[model samples]
Target chain A: MRLAALLMLMMAAAATPAAAHAFLERAVPPVGSELATPPGQIVLTFTEGVEPLFSTIEVRDAHGSVPTGKPRLPPDNARQLVIDLPSLPGGEYTVIWHATSVDTHRTEGSYRFTVH
Target chain B: MSDIEIAAAVLRSVHVAALASLFGTLLFMAVALPVGSGTAQVRRSMRRLVLISGLAGLIAGLAWLTVQSAAIAGADSVAMALHVVPTVALRTQFGHWMLLRLFLLVVALFLMRRPGVAIQIALAGVALAVQPLLGHAGAIGGAAGAQLIASEALHLLAAGAWLGGLLPLFLAVGCLSHEMAAATCRGFTPIGLASVLLLAGTAVMQIATLMGGLPGLFGTGYGHVALLKLGLFVVLLSLAVLNRLVLTDRLAATASTRPHMRVSIAAEMVLGALVVVAAAFLASRTPGTHEQPVWPFAWRLDLGVFSDTASWAEPTIALGATAIGLAIAVAGVIWHRIRWPALGMFAAIEIVAIPHLDVLFVAAYPTSFFTSPTEFAATAIAHGARLFAADCAVCHGVEARGDGPAARSLPLPPADLTANHFRAHNDGELYWFISHGFTAPDGETAMAGFSGVLSSEAIWHLIDYLRAHNAGIAMRRTGSWPQPLPMPQFDAQCSGGRIIDLDDLRGRAALIVAVSGDEQVEPRSFDNIGAAVVVVARGIAATPTGATCIASEPQVWTALAIVLGVSLDALAGTQVLVDQDGWMRAAWRPGDAEDWTDPNTLAARLRDIQSHPIAVNMTGAQVHHH
Candidate 1:
C-alpha cells in the first residue's frame, strides 16, 4: 500500500509537466548520494533523448582529469549516457555532461557523487 | 560553330544522305526504272551511285565513330581519335549498329554489282533497319522500345525511298522520252505516295517517343531543326500532289508542259535533299527525352478557357478534345459524308496534342518537398520543441499555449499553440507560414520568418511538433487511451545479470512493465503478491529493493506499446499485466478512470487475471482450455 502511494505520486509528478531541454533528471548513484562501492559505470539520465554521437559525459577525479572509459550510450535508453569507471580509491568524483539532444539542442550540467 | 559541332554536322549529313542514296537506288531500280534497252545503262549508272554512296557512308560512319570517341574522352589527340573507333564500335549501341550497317552495305554493294537484285534489296533494307538501333529508339526499354525501334526503322526506309529516289526520278524525267517520262511518273506515283504516308506516320511516332510532346518540337535546337524538317516535308508533299495531279498530265500533253514538269521534279528533289540535311541537324542535337535542361516545360493559355497555371488544365483539354473528336467522328459516320477526313483530322490533332500535354502538366505541378510532405515522427516533435523553445517561446509560451512572458508587450497575443487552428491548413501551407512567418493582412509582421535561420527540415520538425501536440490534446480530451490487452512474451536484459524472459514465467503470473522517459513506478508494489514482477527500466533504473529490474530492450518497448494498446507517445507512462501462463491480461495508464492508486482494486485485477485460466481472448474475454 505504501509502494502504491509512491507509484501514484511518481505518476502524478510525471503527468504534471514535461520540458524540451535535456536537463539531468537522475543518476544511478542518485545525484550526490554516497555508495558503499563504486559503480563499474556511471549512468546519467536526462529530460529528453540525447543524441550520443554529438553528446558526451565525462567522469573526472577531484583533480578535474578524466578517470573513466569512453562514455557509451546504451541503445536501451537514448536519454542516458553510461561510462565505465576504472577502480577508484574512496573520494568525491564529478560527472560533467554536455548533451545535444536528437533535436541538436545543447544542454550542460555537472553533478558530484562519493564512493566509500 | 565549334569544330566538333561542325564536324559532327557534316559527318551526320553525309552519312544520312549516303544511306538514303543506297536505299533509294535499290528502290528505284526495283520499282520505277522500266526494263528495256536503257535498263543496262540505267543499272550501271545506279550501281556507280550506290557504290559511291555506300563507300561515302562507311567513311563518314568511321569518322563519326572517331569524333565521338574524341568527344567522349575530352581529348583531341589523333591516337585517341583512332582508339575511339573500336571502342565505340564495341561499346555503344550507335557504334554497333554503324559497324553492322557498314558491313552489310559492303555485302549489298557486292550483291548490287552482281545480278542478285532481291538479295541486294534485302541487304539494303537490313542496313536501314540497323540505323534506328544507333539512335534514340535503341535506348528505349520494354515493348514500347521494340515498337519505337520498329517504327524508326520503317521511318528511315520510307525517308530513303521518298527522298533518296528523287534524284533518280529527276534524272529519268530529263533523259527519257516524254512517253517513258509519263510512264515513269505513273509508276512512281503509287510508291511515292505509300512511302510518304509511311514516312509521315512513323515521323509522328518518333516525335512522340523522342520529343515527348509537341512542346518538344519547340524551344530546343533539336526541336527547331525538326520543325524545319517538318516544313520541308509539307512542301515536298505539296510538290508531289502538284506533280501527280497536274504536272504528270502535262508531261504527256505538250512539249512546253514537259519542261515545266522536269523543273518541278528537280525542285522536289532539291527540297527532299534539304529535308535530309535538316534531319541531320536534328540528329546532332539531343533527343527530347535526353535533353533534360532543354526539355520544354512549356505552358500556354488553351483556347482562352484553360491556363497552365491550373494543375487540371492539361488533362481537361486533352480529355475534352478527345471527346469532341470522337463525337465528330461518330456524327460524320452516321451522316456518311465526312467520316474519313474527320477521322484523319482526329489522328492529326492527337499527333500534335498528346506529347506536349504531359510537359504542360509537369510544368504546372512541379514536385518538391512541399508537394509530397513526409509524415511526422516523435523525434520531429523533440526537434521542433527545441527550435520553438529557442525562437518562438519568448513570444509564445513554453507549452505554446501562447501566453509567453514577451506576449504581454505585443499588440496581439501570440497565436495559441494548443489551438486546433493549425489542423485547418495543409502541411505545405504551414511550412510556407513558418518559412515566411505569419504576416497579417494589414502587412504587419507577427512572427519573424525562420527561412534564413532554421532549415526547411527544422521547420518541418516544428510543424510535426505542433501536429503531435494537437493530437495529444485530442487524445486527452477523448478520455480513453486504447491500449490493447493480451501481452506476448519478449526479451529484456536485467541489472543483476538476470535475463527477464517473459515466456519463461508462464505458470507464474508476471507484472511486466516499463518505466521509461518521465514515468516512474513503485518498484516494490509486487512485494506481497505471489505474481512475479519485472521492471524494464529505461533511463534511470533505480528499482525498489525487492523488484527485478532490467534495462529496457527495444523489442520490449515495441511489444509493450503494442500489447498495452498505447501509442508510443504514452508508452513511457504505461503498465502492462501478463496473466499466469504468459498471456497478457490487461494494461493501465495514467489519467484512466480506474482506481489503480487503490491497492484493493489492483489486487482484484490481478486475482481476476489469475482466476481466468487458459487462453483468454482480450477483446471477447472468451476462455478456452487446451
Candidate 2:
C-alpha cells in the first residue's frame, strides 16, 4: 500500500501543468482580427513573464516594415508587452514578436490583423 | 546536434565520471575495505588514483563551462567563446554554480594527502550534488521540482558509489593475496547491493517526472537515449550478479580464478562508462513530454473498449481464458506427472483467447499521438475555418456533414466529420489522414492528400476549426455541449487604461453580448445580477454606449459566429453565459423566448451554473471512452 501511494504521488507530480516556454497568450488587437479604425499601438501578452530587453515586436505592411518604438513591459504585469505605433492609413498589417523568458527560453510567432 | 552541444556533452560525461571515481574510491577505502588491510603498495596506488581523477575532474569542469559559454554567446569559434567566458561566469546562475563546484573540488584536492577521509568525501559529494542544478531539474519550480531535484541528487550519489567503485575493486583483485582478495570481495558486496537498490528506485522517480509514461518512453529522442542507458545498465547488472554468485566463490576456493574475475570486472567498467555517456546525451536533449511523439507502431491497445458494455464481452472472455490457463500450468508444474497434458491444454486456451483479444487493438499511424503545435484558441479556429473553405469545402461540405457538391463524384462518400465516431480518432491520426489522404479498402482513392497545398501549421489550424465546428453542431442539436468549450478569448479596451480580456472575467459568470449596436439592452443591468458583461460590437463604428469593456474588432464577429454555428448576420444579438471557469455553458439566440435579458431569468441561470461548477478538462482534447 505504501509503494502504491508513492507511485500515485509520482504520477500526480508528472501530470502537473508547467509552462516550459513563453507562448503568445493573447493580444489587444487579436490575431486575425479586423478593425474599423487603426489603433495607436500594439500590445502582446505571453503565457510567462518575458525580458523586455531581449524581446522585440515588429510591425509591417504590404509596402515594407514600419518603424515602431521599443517594446516595454507594463508596470502592473511583467507578461504584458506594449509598443507604440505612429498614425497610419488603413491596410492589412503583420505583427511579429520574439520573446525571451526570465529562464532564457525563447519563442517567436507572427500574425496578421487588418484595419479598415 | 551542433558542434557546441557535442562538446558540452563530452565534457559533462568526463567531469561526472571523474568526480564519481574520486568520491567512490575514498568511500571504499574508508568504509568497505577493512582497516589495516591495505599494504604499503596498495595504499600508494589508491592515493595516485584519487589525485589523477581529482585533477581530471577540475579540468573537465572548466572545459564544460567554456562550451556552455560559447553556446549561450552564439559564438562561432573557441576564441570568441573564451572572450565571453568572464561575462557568463559573472552574469549567469549556471556560471555561479560551476564556480562553487570548482571551489569544492579544489578544497577536496588540497586535503587528499591528509588523513581526513570523511572531509574529502563530504566535499566531493557536495560538488557532485550541484550537477542537477545545472540541468533540466533546475528549471522546474514548486513541490514537484523539489522532489525531482532530491531524487536526482540521490541518483547521482548512488551511481557514484557503484560505478565509481568498480576500478578500485579491479585493482584490489589483481594485487591482493588470495585470502585478502576473497575478503575484499565479501566486504564490497553489501555496499554494492545497497547502491544498486537506491539507483533503481531513484531512476524510476526521475523517469516518471521526465518521460511522462510509456508513450513518451517509446516516442521521443530523450526516451530513446534513456532506453540505451537502461540496456547498458542491465548488462552491467548481469555481470555484477555473475561476479557475486559465481566468480566470488571460485576466487575464494582457488587462486586460478583471480585472472578470470579481473576480466569480468573490466567488462562491467566499460558498460558503466557507456551508461554515463548515454546520460550525458539525454541531459542535452529536451524532455520527452515537451515534444510531439511520432508513434512507431501500427497498432495500439485502446482501453476504451472497457467503457462500452457491448464491446466488453470479447476482452472479458480473453482475460478469463488466459487466467485459467495460467493456473492449470502452475498446478501441473507442481504435480510434475501431468505436465504434458497441462501444456497442451494451456496452448489450446491461448489460441482461443488470442483472437478475442484482437478487439482491444486500434489502427494507428506515425503521427497518431501528436499534439497540436497551435493552441486550441479562437484565433486558430477562425484561421482554420478559412483554410477549410478554400480547400476542404468542395467534398466535405461547408458544414462537414459528407453532403458536399462533390460528394456524388467520389467513389466513396466523404466521411461525416461532425459525428460522434469522429471523436474516436486522435489529433495525430486526423493529421495523418489530412496530410496523407484516405484510401478505401478496395484500393480506390477516397480523398487526395493536401500536403502539397497546405503547410503543416495551416493543417493544425484546420483541425482546430473542425473541433470547434463539431462542438457547435453538438450544442445546437442537443441543447447542451457534450463537453464544454473554452470561451474564445478576446481583448478589449476598458476604462482607466486597463486592458481586459475574456480571461480577466474568470472566477465570475460572464454574459458576452454579440450586438448590432442598435440594441436597447443595458449592459450594466447584468452586473447588478452578479455577472460581468462584455459587449462585442459588430463593427468599430457600432460600439455600444455605456459599456465599460467593448471588443470592436471585426474578426471577433466571424470567430464567435463559427462557435455559434451561425453566419455573420445571424451572430448579432446572440448571448452566451460562461461559467466561472471560462467554459461556455449556455447560449441564447435572438429569437429565443423568455431570454436572459430579463434579470430574474438571468439570475436563475447564474445560480444554477454557480451551484454546479464544471470540472473542465482544460486542454479540450477528447477523452477516450475508457
Candidate 3:
C-alpha cells in the first residue's frame, strides 16, 4: 500500500478534496515543490479555529527530530495558526500538523520540501 | 440577558408598565366620569366601570413600580417626594411627564364619579402624547432616535388601548347590565380608533427603526421578531374584526342573546392577554441590529401582490379594510359621547392596524453584541441559568435539585431547571424578572438577588432554554470572549530606517532646533508633543520664520525630556533636521533615553532602555538589534 501510494502520487494531480469541519489551506512552501533554502518558520492556515494545545507542528530533517520552539501566535492576530521551525540541515524536510478546536473540530496534514 | 441587559430591559419594562397604568387610569376616568340628565341608571353604571378600571390600573402601576425598584437606584427622587406616587415608584424616569400624568389621572378618576366623558377623553390624549419621548430609543441621536420615541409612544398607547381596553370589554361582557353592555361596547369605538392610530404610527416607526426597510426583516434577529409580531398582530386584528362585525351584530340585535358576546369578549380578551404576553417576550428578546441601512441591497418580505421574487406579491384591496379603521377613529373623535358603532369601529380599526408598523422600537446595543454570537449567546445563557437557579431553583434546584441533597435546607425547595422553565410563564411574567430581576427589601429568599448575581444574557438564555423543559428541548451556553480589538500598526516609512543617537543634544544648554529666519509651517510638525523643541510655527504669522533657539535652559530640556521620556542624545545622525515648522525631527531606536513621535523610532534609538509595552513584545517575538 505504501509503494502503491508513492507510485500513484508520481502520476496523480496536485490536489486534495474538500471535506466537512475545519481543515488546512495553503502552506508556506508549495507542498510538493523543491526549494532553494529551508524556511526559518513553518506557518499553517486553517479554515476554522485551532487549539494551541493538541495541535502540533514539526519539521524533521534527514538527521531527524531537531528540537523546536512552541508554536507562537503572531502578535498582530491570534486566530491565524503558526509555528516556528527548528534549524535544520540541508536535506529533505517534512512538516506535519495536527490539532483540535474546543468545538470538537479536528485537522491534520503534511508537506515536504528540500533545502539547497 | 446579562444584568445590564436585564437592567436595561427592566428599566424599560418598568417605565412601560408605569406608563400603561398611568394612561389606563386616565382613560378609565375619561370614559367613566360623565353623568347625563336623562338617565340616573346610565350615569351610575358608567361611574362603577370607571372606578373599577381606574383604580385597578393604579394598582397595576404599583405592580410595575414594585418590579422597578431594582433597576433605578438613589433616593431623594421626585417619585419619593410625590405624596400620591407609590412607595416602589422611581419617579425620576418620567421627569416632568409624571406630574402631568398624575394630575390627569386624578382628574379623570374624580370626574368618572361625577360624569363628563368629553372632558376626560381630551385630557387622556394629552397625557398619552407627553409620554413618548421618555424611552431608551430616544436617548440616541438622528433618525433612529426619532423613530424610537415615536414607536414607544405608539407602543404605550396601543398597549394601553389593547391591554387597558381589556378591563372595560371584559366587564361589558360578563357583569354589566344590558344597558351598560350596550353602552360600554358603544363607548369603545372612539377609544379603540384613537388607540389604533397611535399604535399604527408606533408600529411603523418601530419597524423602520429595527428592520430598517422591509428587506432588513429577515437577515437580522430584529427582523425575525418583527415578522413574528406582524403575524400575531394580524391574528389579533382579525379576531378584533370578528368581535365588531360578527359578534357585535348578534349581541345588539337581540337583548336575550347578549350573554354570547361575553364569551366572544372573553376569547378576545384572552387573545389580547396572549398578545400582551408576546409583547412582553418581544420586549425581552433583543431587537435585531437596525436593518434600515441595508434596504437597497435586499428585498423585504413578499407582499402577496408585490412579491415577484416569491411570487406572493398579490395586493388585496385594504382600502375597505382601512376604511373600517379610519371610520372609527374619526367617528370616535367627532363624537366621543355617542354610544354606538363608533367605539366598536375603533376596536375594529386598531386590531386591524396592528401589522403595518415599520421601525420597531428596541434597546440599542454596542456593535460588539451583534458581531460576536458566541459571546452573546454564552453570556445570555450563563446569566439565564444562574438567574433561574437563584430565583426558580429554590424550587427547581442547583443541578435541578427538586429533591436533591440541598433540598431540605431552604425556605423553598428549588424548582427543576430543566423542567421547561421557559413555558411555565409567558414572556410577560418571565420578563417581569428575567428583564428586571426579583428583589426583596429585607434579606428573604436566596433567589432575591438575581440582578446582582447574574447577567441579563444569562437570564434570557435561561428563559430561552427553560421554556417548559419537560421534553426534548436542547440548551447550550457559549463561552467565547470577544476577539481583542486589533491594535494599529504603522507602516515603516523610512527607506533605510536606522537607530540614531540624540546624545549630542544632551548636557548642552538645550540644542536649538533652528530653522532659518523665514516662516513656512510644515504639516508634520503637528505630530510632535515634545516640550524640548517648541516649534513657533511663525508664532502668529509666517512672515519671519525667525526659527532661532527657543532653546530652553539645559535644566528645562532635561526636565522636559524626563517628563516626555525623550532622548537627549538620541538624534545624533540619520537625516536629522529642523523642519520649516522648526521642530527637530530624527529617527531613533525603540528603547531610547528620550521620547519621539513614533515609539518604534524611539525604541530603535534607545537600544537598551526598557518599558513594558515594547519590552513585552520584543522579548516575546525575540527581535534583536543588529
* Winning model by lDDT: 2
- lDDT by residue (B462-579, candidate 3, tens digit) is 5433431221122112111011111110111111221111222222111222122343333232223231223222122222122222221232222222212234343212122222
TM-score (chain B) for candidate 3 is: 0.41
Which residue segments of model 2 deviate by more than 4 Å? Answer: A1-116, B39-44, B113-116, B142-144, B178-183, B186-209, B320-349, B492-494, B497-509, B524-533, B540-549, B590-595, B598-626
> Which model, 1 or 3, shows the larger TM-score?
1
Interface RMSD of predicted model 3: 22.6
Clash tally for model 2: 0
Which residues of candidate 1, in runs, are more than 4 Å off?
A1-116, B38-40, B219-221, B290-626
**Cα-based lDDT at residue B474, candidate 2:** 81
Question: Candidate 1 — which pairs collide?
Answer: B213-B355, B213-B356, B214-B356, B483-B565, B484-B565, B487-B584, B506-B581
Q: RMSD of each candidate?
A: 20.1, 5.0, 27.6
Give all TM-scores, in the order shown: 0.47, 0.84, 0.37
Q: Candidate 2: which docking quality band? A: incorrect
- Lowest lDDT 10-mer window, candidate 2 chain B? B617-626
Strongest candidate by DockQ? 2
| Candidate 3, superposed: residue stretches over 4 Å from native | A1-116, B2-45, B72-107, B110-115, B126-131, B141-144, B173-198, B211-226, B290-626
Under CAPRI classification, how is model 3 graded?
Answer: incorrect
As a whole number from 0 to 100, the lDDT of residue B539 in candidate 1 is 68
| Candidate 1 residue-wise lDDT at B546 | 50
- Give, for candidate 1 chain B, the lowest lDDT window spanning 10 residues: B617-626
